[model samples]
Target: MNSRKKMRGGPKKFKKLELYSRISFLYLNKAFKNPLILKVAERKHKLVFKFLEKEQADVIAKYKNLKEKKHDEVGVRYIWTLWWQGEDLAPEVVKLCLNQLKENSNGAKVVLITKDNYKDYIELPPYILEKREKGYITFQQLSDIIRFTLLEKYGGLWLDSTIYTSKPIPKEYFDYPFFSQHTKWADTCFVQHNLWHGFCIGSKKGGKLVSFAKEMFFDYWENHDVIVDYLMIDYILMIAYNHFNDIKEEIDSLPYSSERLYELVTILNNEYDEKYFNSLMEECIFSKLDWHKEYKLSIKGKETYYSHIVNLQ
Candidate 1:
């Protein structure tokens, strides 16, 4: 039950209104901070305005051309997200997000993973998809499989559809072995793989981390205790990615066993400033470089190259 309690919190599917309102607010706020500013912005905000406009168009183009957007593109510039329910349940806001990711990709391929066609795009054991179709696995589980396949086979970015980007991921980052962060709550080791969450993970396809991650994820899914907590996924990642002889003791020492998550959900729901969202998006655990030496999670220098609107409900 404690394990269940710890695994209770994760980001939810995005809402269309949330994306519409936030991007709108960002542009409107910039364009009209004051009447004089508005006058200045009329001409000055041209670049930013055009960028936003093109972002929307690209998103639409990607959707219309999803069949043509090859996921085989080389390098870390590719972007992938999952929408298990397919386009029918995907909202317009989510479509806009696909564009936002495309915008951030700087011409790299952007692919949205959905249950209907994930097999066509990602390589995995046929049984995994069979399990998904049998209702024996959750979409989250399916997503884990998809991300691992993507990074292992073709290194790139895997971001949850909920994230909205402000800039392209730095090219230098792709040169790294991989990129991931220890979740803020991971200081205590509460949630699971402190290194990788669903937010945004990057790697050079076929890197050691991605390869190990692929096998570790499958190991847990194929032969684990019947307890159905998603935390086990991270737990598997941590163990697989590292060599902790006393892994049990190490995991037990992590501080994730608290009610802080409940408070976070409350704060996100109440519009208590974007700190919550940014923190969730960021590598809050202290580290000088993108990779944390002790926890072994990759940390981005800038906390946010993107934004998330948590209270869209």
Candidate 2:
């Protein structure tokens, strides 16, 4: 098996997509260039709609002029992809998850929220744009804010577009009232550590934990000067862990390549237990494409920040 995430298209050609200065010329979803790893794995579901489609750079470009949408019912089993600023959805990846959902007893719903549709879901203050422009909240920070808001408003799994789902995830993820990967706590000696990861988070709609998260996130957004995106998420989770008697974060279900996992684990201290860590190992099955394994990713155009992710549409 190839250890590296296989891809075609050299970096120079990848930069061509950004040459278009017009908004209409901006590479749309399926129409855009790929990421550092251009090829998506072959497995995919059949149905493709606006929520998940190619040829829709329009979906990502209208970042400032986003509209709002009506809220869905609570407990809807959906996977959200916030492809703001031309982040890679890699059409095949979207298909893989959708197809796998069909394989299940009951398939899940797919939701792709771009900058245009963001305001509809999240009623954030107008100043968020100012924060974005002032550089206080980067697109990354904005993503963190939106993830929490979406998870709170509509219950489901929120996967960073960078994350690719391999097989069907376990039922406990959707069933649990709340769960997220704790990047800070997983390896550290602090068994009592309360760090909570934001990359992959799942929760019940309007759930107390998520509501608390919404509050905590906005509180930090309103007051903080630094870009401690996960810090706000982590800090509030610790507070929630204490306040909510029923909510405790579960193990990370996002998989990683064993080689990469091993490399990461080698540096950690011994306080992590063998059995506990093994449980997490079961779901850590993805091969994370190191963004700069070869040449560094390039950036161009004012339309978005993530022009480097190669596309396969």
Candidate 3:
């Protein structure tokens, strides 16, 4: 009987391996510039959308007549970031970014949300807490929930801990009721378009878009235990944009922003050039960087961009 069970699992394991190999190949080759990969990705994206269409319909029906509550005018006066274990346990890169955020906050209260104190800011439903306890919701996904809930309840800019700020967050970010880093469709991967960088979002208190997004997230978790897509936040945003005219208008009105959010990371290993670095900083206030990747502080006796950023006061 044991031998039979092992035999039954062999093909399933092999199939998973085959799928992972294909994914790795496509990632390494930038989708391999392959027509077949593009077609397959397009088809998959459509299917995912189709699967969620009913949920979109339900959300629209539920919120179609919704009226926002009146709140005192409070612009984005808080900057939020999360490090689940706490900042003292954060990676070196995250600490550097946190310092930069404080240095350039321009009076915005920089709040560091940690596992010990996250509940002080937002109260999530019990079901969501149960799911988290059961390991259904990850720390990263919890951060997503925290961001929307905080934005919905109180106006602020939610910055992913990985974001590096070079200057005071511009006043333009606070001008909108809802704001995100907008980019052209051509700038995205084939699987995604109509995406606003979820890593950085600026919003006003009681904004409709964020309030709806929080509802959508709650609805999703109430009915489903497993996440359907890795980029579920982006997918939720896309669904909102497609199904609601008001949400669409709000997103469409946001100016193109942070077009080069990843440019600094690309040159992190290259020899540092102060002129080029200053120009890049002048162009964009924030750059999204990854803490998971290993970067050299100095390469072969030459200082790299990563080194320069780390050394910046």
TM-score of 3: 0.86
Q: Lowest-scoring 10 consecutive residues by lDDT in candidate 2?
A: 40-49
Q: Per-residue lDDT of 53-87 in model 2, one digit per residue for the tens?
A: 22222322322133223334444587776666433
- Lowest lDDT 10-residue stretch of candidate 3: 1-10
Best by the TM-score measure: 3
Output the TM-score of candidate 2. 0.51
- Model 1 off-target regions past 4 Å? 1-76, 182-186, 192-196, 223-228, 241-313
What tens-digit string does per-residue lDDT give for candidate 3 at 1-313?
2121212223443344345334534663366446566555555556557656664567767766665445566654888899988999999989999999999998889999998998898899998898889887776677888899999888889999989999988765776778888776652333435347888887888877788778878877776666555566777777777776777777887787657888887899899999999999998788988898888989889999999988886
Q: Give the TM-score of candidate 1.
A: 0.52
**What TM-score fits each model?**
0.52, 0.51, 0.86
RMSD of each: 20.6, 19.4, 6.0
Scored against the true structure, residue 36 in model 2 reaches a CA lDDT of 17
Q: lDDT per prediction?
A: 0.47, 0.46, 0.76
Stretches of candidate 3 exceeding 4 Å from the true structure: 1-29, 32-35, 65-72, 190-195
